[model samples]
Every structure is written in structure tokens, then in C-alpha cells.
Target: MITLLIIAAALVGIIFGVAAILPNDGYGHRPVPRSHVDSYPTHNPFL
Candidate 1:
């Protein structure tokens, strides 16, 4: 049980470290491309 807690703590630390090292695009996240969004069909049946 103690080992499990330690492993979980280590994983959380690593995740935060990686996240901190990632580039910030000012928006805080990468934007989805327009082609990806347009590929999905719209749900409006009345149109």
C-alpha cells in the first residue's frame, strides 16, 4: 500500500514536470484545424 502511494506520487510529479516543459502557444492549448471540424457531419435534419 505504501509502495503504491509512492508510485502514484512519482507519476503525478512526472506528469506535472512534462506539462511544465511543454510550449505555450499563448492560447494555452493547440487549436483544432478547420478541416478536422468540417469532416464531421452536422446534426440538423431540417436543413
Candidate 2:
């Protein structure tokens, strides 16, 4: 029973983790992939 409970809790955590990072659909919403972060200028004063 304890093992089953642990597995259930882990599954819930995984679901929440995925939801936390997923992007929402709306105006002005831009999703930048990890591969593109390095392409941005680091010396920009606005950053």
C-alpha cells in the first residue's frame, strides 16, 4: 500500500511539473526554445 501511494504521488508530481512549464495561449505570448536562448545578445542594455 505504501509503494502504491508513493507511485501515485510521483505521478501527480510529474503532471504538475509538466503543467508548470507548458505555455499558455494568448496575445503577446512567445515561446522561446532552449536552443535559441544563446542566440540572444547578452550585452543589450534593455535586458
Candidate 3:
């Protein structure tokens, strides 16, 4: 029926929209660390 077709199309759109928004971090990817520290260090040693 026309109703069934509309439901199917809506589901497909939701799936594609979610996929586009999510991050694509792949397997075994390591995050890079900051290259340099803050120029003016905080007075609090705990920081």
C-alpha cells in the first residue's frame, strides 16, 4: 500500500541521516596528543 511505501522511505532516510552525522573513527585508530604545553602554566601544581 501507499502507507507501507511511505514508512519504508522514512526508515531509509533516518538510517542515512544518522550515518552521516556519526563520526567515522576506524579500527585501531590512535588519538594524537597535543604537541606543545600551555605557554603560561597554571600556578596550581595539581592542574
Candidate 4:
């Protein structure tokens, strides 16, 4: 019974640790995808 309680506590600790380590935008919004930004051309050969 004690071992089961310890296991459950360890699982909870791991979950909190993982959540803290994850990256987050200041506004709680995910950053735009790389592919979306690449769609707009930054340079033109004729320019």
C-alpha cells in the first residue's frame, strides 16, 4: 500500500515538472509555424 502511494506521488511530481519545463508564450498562445512565415517572400530578384 505504501509503495502504491509513493508511485502515485512520483507520477504527480513528474507531471508538474514536465509542465513547468514546457515553453509558453507570454500571452499563452503558441508561436506561429515556420512554414506560415516562409509563405511570404522577403526578397525579389527584380528589385
List model 2 lDDT by residue over 8-47, tens digit each: 8777666544533556212234435543223433322212
* Candidate 3 per-residue C-alpha lDDT over 1-47 given as tens digits, one digit per residue, 9 for 90 to 100: 99999888777666544533445212233222341113323222222
TM-score attained by model 1: 0.50
Encode model 4's per-residue lDDT on 3-27: one tens digit a residue. 9998887776665445334563223
- The TM-score measured for candidate 2 stands at 0.49
Model 2 per-residue lDDT at 25: 16
lDDT by residue (tens digit), candidate 1, 1-47: 99999888777666544543455322466424432222324322121
- Assess the local accuracy of residue 46 in candidate 1 as a C-alpha lDDT between 0 and 100: 20
Superposed on all Cα atoms, model 1 deviates from the true structure by an RMSD in Å of: 13.6
TM value for model 3 = 0.49
Any runs in candidate 3 off by more than 4 Å, and if so which?
A: 25-47
Going through the candidates in the order shown, the clash numbers are 0, 0, 0, 0
In candidate 4, which residue pairs get closer than 3 Å at backbone N, Cα or C atoms, i.e. clash?
Answer: none
CA displacement after TM-score superposition, residue 31 of candidate 3 (Å)? 18
Minimal lDDT window, size 10, model 1: 38-47
Give residue 35's lDDT in candidate 3 (0 to 100). 17
Against the reference, the lDDT scores of all candidates come to 0.46, 0.46, 0.42, 0.46
